[model samples]
Target: MRKVLESLQRGAHAGLVLDRFGPLAPTDEKNLPERKDRHLTAVLEAAGSGATRELYALAFERRRSTSDPELSRSFQRSVDGAMVIGLGIASTLEAGLRLHQTYGVPFVPGSSIKGLAAHWCHRVLGDDRGGEHREAPLWRKEGDYHRFLFGTTEACGAIVFEDAWPIPNSIAGANGGLRREVMTPHHLDWQGGKGAPTDFDSPTPVGFLSMVGRYDFRITWNGPPAESATIAGWLDRAAEIVSCALVDWGIGAKTSSGFGRMVEAETGNRANAIATVAVAPVGNRADKRSSGTPARVTLVAARPKGGFDVQEEGRALGTLTLGTSPAGLSPEIGMTVDVQVHNDDPVKPQYKWPVASKPAKSVPPSKRR
Candidate 1:
């Protein structure tokens, strides 16, 4: 157990066990192997399987937030595979990065998501702290819907908010991965309206903090049932309102500069890719490599003992076994290699190429100045 924690801290792909896996025994890095490396945060063997499979195992355990993907799946319609962007970084790390204890995957707590939903609900109804009064049941009286639904100092809310998890390999755009962003707090010396901006009040640049990409959300519908419509209608309306709220107001730490805004993710392409991988008997896009098709793939992580994962063109092409490459080359995270599958092996064909390679220069030789 100590060895595994040591592996996690010391840049080893021990596949950091999630909190549900069991309590992580205490360990110190002092006795572990001396390897000064900052490893890329990723998941274990089951990272990119069906979302349902992963969520069922991870949903209810040791989560800090209400963003559970498993709970969200129960609802019908477009909210499935929906995204909730950076909810904020409240962490022990100096830079304040939060991750799933087991998979090292970043996420937004379901509690925060619930807050977003409630905020959205209130905003749409024009009851956002307006100090307006109305009647019973739907309109509010003692032991009314709001109190019953959201709870009070004496009771807990009926709704069960679930922790949100990122869809594996759902990083959008070219450099789809965790990003470090800088936050600066200016005029920290002034308290209230007591002080004015001066030369002494230099801008303080907080260290670059890590933030994750878009994520999927799931919130259970154990709260109050709609007085007027079916549960489905209630959920649909709530989903629509909250989705808009996320985009308009955003969530988490820095909203003025736009930090936690999110929208539904269109995962069709990824879905197709996963399906292709499951059904394909032999041929695939990676087939071009046999014909000497050279493409750039980012190596996410490599096991100190053996294999590593390859993400080509913003998509994970599965882990490739690090066979005997020319010269003894060790694997490193964030290394790019030009590669393609050399042959059609029945069992997920392992591609052959240099452990690392450079991108072919786009400019034609004649066009180069």
Candidate 2:
């Protein structure tokens, strides 16, 4: 099996390799842990070749262009942290990753997206009914927005949530759309119900595949043309709900652990209200913004190599490379920092270190000789 896996040329389907060709360790082997580590490392390395990247790029392009401008509203989002989908799927390594069957790239399934939105609508948006012990039903029977948008068990919805694919070159790493992650379980015996959890328990570190990058989400209206205006309003609202859900509640496995949060990326067109819901322009000319204007940007994530992926409000401001800490402040995820914008070209704005306020000179104490 190992020889067969090695013989396969580069760019082979990563999902196939991980699921089918992964090396196994003997149960009684003394070096089982070492073998497992080696196997996971090899799998991680094999999954991120140049050929796979090209394939992902092609797939992204094709998917992005497929939705009709008139019928569909598309938006892009940058993942705020690591996202793991299909984590329960059986795998030799005990952790699973969902990848595109054809392109072998990480993607958010449309069904999953819809499910998250639906759940959010039911729990958060649904209006409260009467009873003291009661909450809002799945949806109200009369003029139910949820029913119209997501549809009932009897009928299909007016809108379709398309599968989300990553933006090309968005993931800041050599790895093709995937990141290697580790999970350490400290109380395995407690979890197995064999013993009480204690600090002295040995921690088992398990490696898994996760993703961090920009993902393009699309939702299209396919209902009656006569009702387009009404549906468009609903679609816009739906987009906002989904955006809020992605950013707040998150999606996919381990969301409670902050695994799938995403923020809206900048878009050129404001006409598509659905796409422009959460994103804010960095320094719009209409705002009388000029070069070197200080702007507050949020640190989204640290780049694998160096620097940090920063965003203004929800709009992505691109990677900020710093040879030294600005104002002697270290960059950390989710921290907001003020930066000077070099907006000579509005399309490709550059962020510079904020003009540091000079510190007050300390007064020399008079010597009492």
Q: Give the Cα lDDT of each candidate.
A: 0.43, 0.66
Scored by TM-score, the top model is 2
- Once fitted onto the true fold, the runs of candidate 1 whose alpha carbons sit more than 4 angstroms away are 1-9, 12-94, 128-145, 172-176, 188-196, 223-229, 267-369
What TM-score does model 1 achieve against the real structure?
0.44
Clashes, model 2: 0
lDDT of 1 by residue, 1-369 (tens): 545654442221122322223223325655221211122222222232233334433553334244344333332112222222333334222244455555455566777767776655444433423444221122122223333334456545545556666554453322232454545667776744768868677675554333445455555555422222233333443455445555666666666665665544553122211111121211234433353345555554443346654444422233556445545655465566656554433323455565455668699789879
lDDT (C-alpha) at residue 59 in model 1: 51
How far does residue 55 in candidate 1 sit from its true spot (Å)?
A: 11
**Model 2: per-residue Cα lDDT at residue 271:** 32
- Residue runs of model 2 more than 4 Å from their true location after superposition: 1-11, 127-143, 267-369
Q: Assess candidate 1 and give its lDDT.
A: 0.43
Question: How does candidate 2 fare on TM-score?
Answer: 0.64
Cα misplacement distance, residue 120 of candidate 1 (Å): 2.7
